[model samples]
Target chain A: MKTLSYFLILAFSGGEHAGGGSPLDVNPGLILWTVVTFIFLLLILKKLAWKPILKSLNDRENLIKESLEKAEVARKEAEKLIAENKLNMQKSEEEAQKIIEQSRELAEKLKMQILEDSKKTANKMLEDAKAEIERKNAEAFNKLKEQVADIAITAAEKILKENLDKAKQINIVDKYLNEINKN
Target chain B: MYTGQELIGADTLKQVAETAKKTDTSWIMHDVLDANEIDLTPFGIIHLPHLNLFGFDISITKHVVFMWIAMLILIFVLKKVAKSYKSSLIPKGVTNLTETLILFVRDEIAKPTIGKGYENFLPYLLTVFFFILTCNFLGLIPYGSTATGNISVTATLATLSFLVIQIGGIWKNGFFGYFKGLLPHGIPAWLIPIMFVVELLGLFTKPFALAIRLFANMTAGHIVILALIGLIFILHTYVVVPISIAFALFIFLLEILVALIQAYIFTMLSSLFIGMAVHQEH
Candidate 1:
């Protein structure tokens, strides 16, 4: 390797003095130096600069991509939650409507039941009042008939006492009683 | 186009050197384009120290130093941004800017061109984009030279891309399959050799254009700016300074845009070539 580089240097520097007339001359030495310098620069830079920079750039790109994917998932989840909420709200509203209808039916039935109960109670009260009035009228008519019977008996007894003697009265009364009986 | 005095000065020095060589004059100096003299080297506006290592002239030129500065700047800024990246998921400030650029290269350039295999080449594309951009921007600085403007440097980068393209092909399709895949299925056997040559040339021409396009574009911008500044020097008058400075500033701002554009073009073309090599459907 050393000998090869030495030969390369000699060969490159050999034509240095050939073109002295113009400044457009070629210098093999400068060529050798430039080649060495450029190669050295390339190697060092590849190791130190390009490797890490490219890696970081790629890393940042991947990070952004992953974040975007995560955001999409989150947005989808939010949409699903919103849809579920809407569905739940609809179900609750339906339940509330059903409850209102049931209560209205129940109220109508309750009003009818109350009206029937009041009519039955009013009929029973009217029948009880008519029975009491009929019983009081029958009791008054019996009492008046008993009093007229007593007065008629008293008047007949007084008339018999005033008109005739004892025996004759008895015979006359018998005759009269017989005549009264025949009449 | 009025040439600059620096070129005229070099020409005179060259003439002086040739004359001295022929006549052995006593008063002739040792170095004509010496450090003390004005530098007219095509590679750099200011001459720098020449370094030699292991029988090779590894000179510390202005472009090399500026390339190092650009590299250091890239390392420091990227490291800081990388540290910030570790702590936070979101980017801010310089981290935000750098991340935007990196992501643009990945999504717009690497991903669209390379497709499924973009990850494998992202680091390399990023490196080329940043390195070339830094080098291009360095040129717009007052005294900083553009290393990408140099042919050797641009050639080296292009060669790297070419190597990646071929290697990616070979790795995707085995050695034999890769060579076989180059020729179309319906071609006559007599035309196979000609087709092979054409395809191979096509392979080379792509990277060649890459290197030349970057080098020429970067070099041309600087030359225009220098030429604009040279106008002031050629006229040798203070009256021309405002106009020259204004034009130079306008081109300098334009250079900033061109610098970014050329870097993007280089990386985009590289990714396209690699994509074609690895997937070779048509």
Candidate 2:
């Protein structure tokens, strides 16, 4: 089994130095070159590639963060504006309601004033008509009184001329007038 | 130092020498390293003249060349993305895709693991992730070698991670405090030494695993594919061709997933280690 294993190891390992020599053999020159090459690569890449790439990555990250923050701020501002607009709308609605109320009150007061003025005018007209009728009746009665007195005078003059003396006629007329006034 | 063909040729020469010696014929023998059936040496595909400096073998290998190509590709693509990123705030095309990867490393890996001090180590994590990913993917392409498959390369990366973890800890907590924090408080004095050793070993084991895991995973896929192809040559049969090719293709697809996963694992672990080191409270 040990011999077979050794044979297998040898066969699989490329039949005695197939891929290269003993894999353990270290070449000094290669080592030096690798070190120099790697260091050179490190220095060059550090200066040229990595710095810019890292910076750009960081910059992009910051930019994204800033933009997100700005968006958040803008959203807040919009919300505030909407709230303010809603408040203003409510305030305007209230003002419209108040104006409507005021106008309604004014209309009611005006209607009342007009009714009172018309009532006053109607009452004054009624009183004036009553006074005018009274004055007309009094004038008519005065005229009739004058007329009756004049007629009586005329009749007495006629009768006296026909059959009665002048002094008796004057006394009789006075008594008659007094009796008529008393009746 | 031995190329694959040279190694194979030496094997042939050795066989010839052995036969000749047995047959009582004159033959030349040269000392050579045992030739592996699959010579995995990262050399000899394209002859690059060796240049030495300070006693170090700096001869560029196939893996090194591929690594350079991967680096150039990464640089070009990332630079273009950087330009677009700089010019316009909105990411487009390649920039968009690359940004997703970058952000993943930062947010998922670095931030979650490293916490507050994630920023300091992010670049290193990003570099390691992209570099390893690029290297792993490049290997899948025809004629491309995986630099990450090399132990030396992975070891170097692991060492870097280890260094960062240590340095970050020391920097965050003073030197004495950092080492002191390794041992849990309220432990018995006798047991403290054992716990300290265990903790010290734990520190090394983490990076060691990082290196071995990446190196093995990356190399294993390539070996499987190579072995599958090698079956055709070994059997010398047309029947094996379709089977080998089909299996290789399957493994190749799986490798793409492994490539990304390994890169992620490396980066994630590195960050975790650094996070642990810097913030010892947790």
Clashing residue pair totals per candidate (backbone < 3 A): 1, 3
Q: In order, what lDDT does every prediction score?
A: 0.79, 0.81
Docking class of 2: incorrect
Q: Tens digit of lDDT per residue, candidate 2, span A1-183?
A: 443454455434432333344556787877887888888888988888888778888998899899999999999999999999999999999999999999999999999999999999999999999999999999999998997887688766755665577777777778767766874
Give the CA lDDT, 0 to 100, for residue B243 in model 2: 96
Clashing pairs in 2: A17-B38, A18-B38, A20-B40
Looking at model 2, residue B60 earns an lDDT score of 70
Interface RMSD of each: 12.6, 8.9
State every prediction's TM-score relative to the real structure. 0.72, 0.74
- Model 2 misplaced stretches (Cα beyond 4 Å): A5-20, A112-183, B1-46, B225-250
Q: Give lDDT tens digits, candidate 1, residues B1-282.
A: 235655565566566556534543221111110121223446545557777788998877656777789989999999989899789989999999999999999999999898877899899999999999999997776545678988788988999999998998899888888888888889899999999999999999999999999988997777777767766766668999999999999998999999999999999999999998887775
Task: Spell out the clash pairs found in candidate 1.
Answer: A23-B42
| Candidate maximizing lDDT | 2
Model 1 TM-score?
Answer: 0.72
